[model samples]
Target chain A: MHVLVLGSGQLARMMSLAGAPLNITMSAYDVTTDRVVHPLTQAVIDQTLDQAIAAADVITAEFEHIPHDILAICDKSGKFLPSTDAIKAGGDRRLEKALLDNSGVKNATYYVINNRADFDAAIQHVGIPMVLKSALGGYDGKGQWRLKDSTQVDTIWQEMQECLNGSAQQAIVAEQFVAFDREVSLVGARSASGEVAVYPLAENIHVNGVLSLSTAIDAPELQEQAKQMFTAVANSLDYVGVLAIEFFDVNGELLVNEIAPRVHNSGHWTQQGAEVCQFENHVRAVCGLPLGSTKLVRETAMINILGEDTLPTELLAMEGCHIHWYGKGKRPGRKMGHINVTADYSGELQRKLCEIAGYLDAKAFPAVHEVAQKIRS
Target chain B: MHVLVLGSGQLARMMSLAGAPLNITMSAYDVTTDRVVHPLTQAVIDQTLDQAIAAADVITAEFEHIPHDILAICDKSGKFLPSTDAIKAGGDRRLEKALLDNSGVKNATYYVINNRADFDAAIQHVGIPMVLKSALGGYDGKGQWRLKDSTQVDTIWQEMQECLNGSAQQAIVAEQFVAFDREVSLVGARSASGEVAVYPLAENIHVNGVLSLSTAIDAPELQEQAKQMFTAVANSLDYVGVLAIEFFDVNGELLVNEIAPRVHNSGHWTQQGAEVCQFENHVRAVCGLPLGSTKLVRETAMINILGEDTLPTELLAMEGCHIHWYGKGKRPGRKMGHINVTADYSGELQRKLCEIAGYLDAKAFPAVHEVAQKIRS
Candidate 1:
């Protein structure tokens, strides 16, 4: 079976790696170029858009920002998985909140807004210490504004108005603040046969609102809860591929932060930690194949190598940590690669994490500080 | 750092996958086309053999049967790993036994034979219950003869002579049979830095003299001793990549059977069971990168898919079993693919194994067998 992905990036490259061994061809729809290339360059898929869509047995997106025209072509071909409606819901916070509410899923309290008056009214009702998020095109903390106090509300509103860029009104949503202790994600897949397999919950950490690291652990209770959540959401939407739900741990209560309607960044640890990677499972579900095992092998931590200013070559020589650099040019705050560190013992995970963080930024640790202090001493 | 592999097959394909994420370029020398293609079609390598050898940071092989000329070129470049001597020792059984004797390694008592008379003499010396094997180009029970009794020796010798087919004198070896309970393999890697890590010993089972399944387990004391023996061999030879040492478990003693200079089929389970697969770890060691974690997540069983005709699609539907097809044109006895089944519980592994074996041949297992039939009214 052949699978077509909407974005031509490293995620697509990895999906190709996972699919090629199954004899399933993975071709990408380069949204930017409007041309198709085998995700890993095994085959050139540069046919007309319609022809390419027709050639595939199933179509999915690597990211939510896929061009609407391409999605329309896929919709006409009837090859899109997770459905366009699901993607739209995932893309727009208002739509997602409404879907969650209707499905009886738990999420942060929020309300939709259209204009300044609406925003003011939301603050009156939801109060300060709330988050304002654009209905679409928001990720990595962009397009989201945190209102601290009434004294700063006017300046924040003015800045938000500047962000709208001359549009008299733009769609946005307000969410009540939740003081969560930790963040985690559940990556799961559902086959057309309705067989759903959920990978272990992955604890995630972010730096500057961008994912910095993720670790997969065996938490029986978390796994049970995550599996039920995934099943509920997948069954409700008739989802037929992989999806990831981000959850905030608020004093042991799980609050749904958002859902990614495709393979997610937090799941990258599965490439080395699980029996079957999320990429392969996604392809399996979409291609009408059997869902694979999602069992974790050991404690695994994946560190995103963001804004690559060249990683220390010395760190690449460290045992137990495998470097994975996306074949992408470096850009600040952009994901260029990641390092996966696996260990048999849980304590080793933290050691590896510290070692990796130290390698990335020497000054971030006391050993590095001591070295600097020694130079000064 | 860049690494070049000498074969463009599944081993090379896997090596490429492992290398790509590190941004380390790996090109495979395609003997059929006399051109180098990126192991995964990710890069175009040098077309000329000389240029490939020159451009390569280190040279290694996916199989021991690499062309001697190319091996010599790489040897001349002073960049070849595992060494041509080691590969030659692995490729031919006579040389292999000789090396074992010289290294003082424990192995089956054997003697080389050049004629029917020599074969008879060796059988007499080694005893009646002996096995005769061709010195070269033999694997999975091919080019082998069994001598059961003295009366049948002449006929067996004559038949073996006929099988040899008039080549002046065909080289062969005869060995006294040793009672073995099971087979085990030690897969380990030695880095350029002289650091070595051996994966947990894998217990293996063979059907029709071909490896049918393997599982990683904690080795007994005797097995640990055998692993130390392998470590000595690896260090003595200055081997810098993954090596497989097959052993025969006789009574409670472990004796060496054979050695593979490159990654062996038995190690395929590591693709899903370990933090870093054998192929990638081999590439990393050869490229002077640090070794990856070799911790096994759970017990894993790998079943080789032999011959296209026996390819079982039903096995793909089984839970926790991931099927990998090599995309090679299937032929009788050809290794087209494999399935890796893993689980936190050993029962899951056995269940998947039975399901897979059942898919291959239903008649092999009795659907319903009554041990006793009572003559009841």
Candidate 2:
């Protein structure tokens, strides 16, 4: 089977690797290029866009932000997975909130706004300490406004008016903030056959609302609840392929926070922890194959290597730490790669996390040479 | 780094995959094609043999049976891993035994022979109930003859003579048979800098001496012993890539059975169980990157899917079971694929194993339908 991926990136590259042995050929288009290459090759396959699309048996995306024109072509082919509707729901906060309400998936209260009057009314309804998100193309805390005080209301209203252009209308959401203990995400896949396989709930740690680390465990109650929520959402959208649902754990309440309608960064540990990786499962689901397992092999912690941090050779020298470099040119706050450290012992897992974090942060471990130097002093 | 591979097979394919992300390119030359393609691609990258070698930074084989001409080219490059010297020891039983004896690694006593008379004398010297093996190009119970009684020796001698052809003498090993409890293998990777990482010892089961299943677990004592032996052999050969040592558990003694200079089939579980797979480690070692963690994630059992059996969908439907199908046209006794199953609970692991094995073997479980049929009967 031939699969065409809408975006060409690491996820598409990984999907190509996973699909190769199954005799499922993957060709991905970099919307920027007319030349289509096998994801792993980064070499030219088809010189024309139409030929590449004609060659594909199925069409899917590595992420939700696929260009509307490309998605329209796929929709016309009647072979696109997770559907354009599902993707739009995931991409726009307003659509996502509406879908959640209609699907009966519990979520934080939200109000959509188009102009200053609507924004003012939303502020009145939701009050201060609310999250105002652009309805489109917002991620990792980008294009977001947080109202922390009433003094900022006038500035926010002006900003909203400017954002709306001359029509005094622009789509956005003002959501009531839920004070949560922790953030978790359920990365799950559903096939066209309505078969759903949910990976273990990943406890995510975010630095400035960007995912930094995700750890997986057998938290039975949490897993079961997350599984139910994921399944219900997948079924409601008639979703085919992988979906990641981020949840705000307010005490025991799992308030729906967001959704990623593609294989997510949070599920990266499944590459080593499970028999089948989330990327592979997404390919299988999108290609209409039976879903593979979503079981965790060990407690695994995945740390994002943001920017050009000097690698800690000492960390690689340690047991149970696996490093993956993306080979991308690095910039500040850019995702260069990640390291997955897995172990049976939670204490060891914690130590590994601290060690990697220290290395990436360039914070020297004080327990060894420093201790000796201090003793001599 | 540029890596030249001797054999163009799946192991080579995987090595290429591991190398790609690191910007370490691999070129594999199939004896038939002679055209070097990017290993991940079986597409031609270099049409001339000399050009391929000239482009290589390191040369290696995916298997031991590399044709002599290719070995000579790699040998002249002075960059061949597990060196051509070490590979020679692994490819032939006589050389393997000689190396084992010189290195003081434990092994069954053996003597080389060229003819039936030599074999008979060696058997008389070593005693009956012995094993005979051809010196080269044998794997998984091939090119082997087992002698249980003297009465059948003459007929076996005739078959051996035909197998040997007329060099007037072909090499073979005559040794006492090991009465073993179970078989196991240790896979270790060493870098040019003398840094080495050993994956946990894997318990293996072979059906008719062809590996059927393998389970890798963290047994500290066994791991230390295996590490000691592997490190000794690796250091002795100045090996700079993956080395797999197969062992026989003779009553409590770990007698070395054979050695593979390339990634061995037994280490397939490492794909799911280890922090870094043996293939990735081989790539890292050859590419001059720091070696990855060899820690086992959990107790994992990998089952080879042999022959032309159609895999059942139910097996894939199970949690924690991942199937990897080789894109090969199937035949009886051909390796179609393998399944790696892991679990948090031993009971669940065993149950999954049985459920998957039953599906593959076409044995139905005792379900409500079966119970109802039994009641009717």
Candidate 3:
């Protein structure tokens, strides 16, 4: 089966790797280049979007931030999986908030702000200590502000207005920021036949708004809550393929922060920790193949290799530590690659994490260093 | 890092897949077409052999049957790994026998035959119950004869004479065939610093001289013996990549049957069962990187998917069962793909093997069926 992913990036490249063994060929549509290419090789194929869609047995997106016109074309092909609405909602916080409300999932109360008056109204509705996020095209802390007090509203609004004015469809989403104990994510796949399989909840740590560390955790209470919310969101959308929902763990109760309508970085640990990796599961779901088991087989953590193209060669000598480079040229703070560290038993993963930290730059990999320090203490 | 593989078959394809994660890009030299190609896509790359060799950081072969002229060219480049002599010995039975003897490893007593006179002399020297195999290009039970008794000598010699007269390089190596209880193979890697890392011995089962099944076994005595032979052979060749030595297990004593200069079929179980897979380890050795651990992480068995392209969808739903297709067209008796079945603990793998046998054809997967039957009864 040939699957045409609607974005040419690391996610598509990983999907290609996972799909190859199952005889599922993966190609990516470079939205910028307007060309179809082999994701892994990045070699351009002489085919238009329509031609690619026609050739594909299934179509899916690697990221939710795809152009609506392109998404519509793929959706019209009747080969796209996980529904076009899910993709749009994932990209737009306004739609995402409505989706959470409609699905009856626990999430932060929010109001959309389009202008100065709307911003004033949002402050009244959502109150102080709110988080302002651009409703469209905002990710990894970009186009965001934290309103801790009334004093910072003017400065925050000036930035928010610039983002809103830049894109006519953009608006500000003011959410009531909950003081959460920790952040966690649930990555699960829903099959065409409504079979849902969720991996263990990954306790996440973000450094400067980008995910830095994600470890598969065994908190039964958090997992049960996350799985329920995952099922609700997935069922409401009638989702096909993998979906990741980031949640704020507020004193053990989960609140949906956002959703990704594709395989996620937090689930990368599944490549070594679980029965089947999320990339393969996503392809299996979209292609109408049965979902492989998502059972966790090992204690594992994944550390994002941001910006740096090179890592300590000693990392290769460490057993159960697998480095995966994305084959992308290095740029400051770019998602260059990741390392998945697996352990045989409980607590061993923590020790491995500490050992891994000794080799990484503390500033570049703050989350790993923090975990190491915390564990050592 | 860029790697140029010698052959554009499934082995090269898998090696490319394995190498990609390490930011190692792989291109293949298609010996038959004399063109460079992407091993996975089989897309022709517009580069001459000399250009590819110059561009490559490392050059290796997926198989040992490469033409000597190409080997000479690559060897001259000072980047081709594991030495050229190891590959030549693997391809020629006469050289392979000498290698085993020179390495001081136990093997079958053999005599080389060039004509009818030599065949008569070989019979007198080696005695009855012998196996006759072509010195060059013999594999998968082809170009072979069994001289079990004096009654079959005349017909066997007639067939041998035609093969000898066909090419000046052709010769039959007559060996004293000792009845062995089972077959096992040791796949290991020798790095540039002469660091050797060997995986657990894989108990292999062959159907019609074609490998059908391999399972990682925990026979300490056999493992120690196999490792000794593996180290001897690899050290003798100064090998710098994965080398597989096949053995005849006669009451736990191992006799080196043959050696493959590249990764072997028996090591396929490592993909799902071991800490670091053989393909990745082979690439690491050739690229001058530290070798990863060769620890068995799961109880697993690999079943060759010979001559079949499609499998039942329910097989995908089976826990711990992973299917790997070579993305090749179906051909009669071709090694199209394989299924790696992993289990959490001891005895679970045998039960899963039986379950897998239920979904496979008895004739197509006779080795799996035999193991299942043996385990059950």
Which numbered prediction scores highest in TM-score against the true structure? 3
User: Comparing to the true complex, what docking class would candidate 3 get?
Assistant: high
Residue clash pairs of candidate 2: none
* CAPRI tier for the interface of model 1: acceptable
> Residues A1-377, candidate 2, lDDT per residue (tens digit)?
88999877878887887787566778888887656877877777745767777888998988776667777888998888989988888877888998888878889888888877888889888877998888877899876888889899888877766665643334779999788898999999999989898888888877776777788866788787888889888999999999999999888778889988999999988876665788889988988888887767667877777776457577666677766666566687787777777777776676666655555543222222222333345
Query: By the TM-score metric, which is better: model 1 or model 3?
Result: 3
Query: Candidate 1 chain B, which ten residues in sequence have the lowest lDDT sum?
Result: B368-377
Pairs that collide in candidate 1 are none
Task: List A-chain TM-scores for all predictions.
Answer: 0.92, 0.91, 0.99
* Model 3 Cα lDDT, one tens digit per residue, B55-143: 99999998888899999999999999888999999999999999999999999999999988898899989999999999999998899
What value does the lDDT take at residue A14 in candidate 1?
84
Q: Clashing residue pairs in candidate 3, if any?
A: none
Q: What share of the true interface contacts does each candidate keep?
A: 0.63, 0.61, 0.97
Model 1 ranges with Cα > 4 A deviation: A41-48, A109-117, A166-170, A217-232, A293-297, A309-322, A343-348, A351-377, B38-46, B114-129, B149-170, B308-319, B345-377
Which lDDT tens digits does candidate 3 get at residues A1-377?
99999999999999999999999998999998899999999999999999999999999999988899999999899999889999999999999999999999999989999999999999999999999999999999888899999999999888888898998998999999899999999999999999999999999999889999999999999899899999999999999999999999998899999999999999999999999999999999999999999999999999999999999999999999999999999999999999999999868888888989999999889999999999999
Question: Looking at candidate 1, what is the lDDT of residue A329?
Answer: 74
Runs in model 3 lying further than 4 Å from the true structure: none
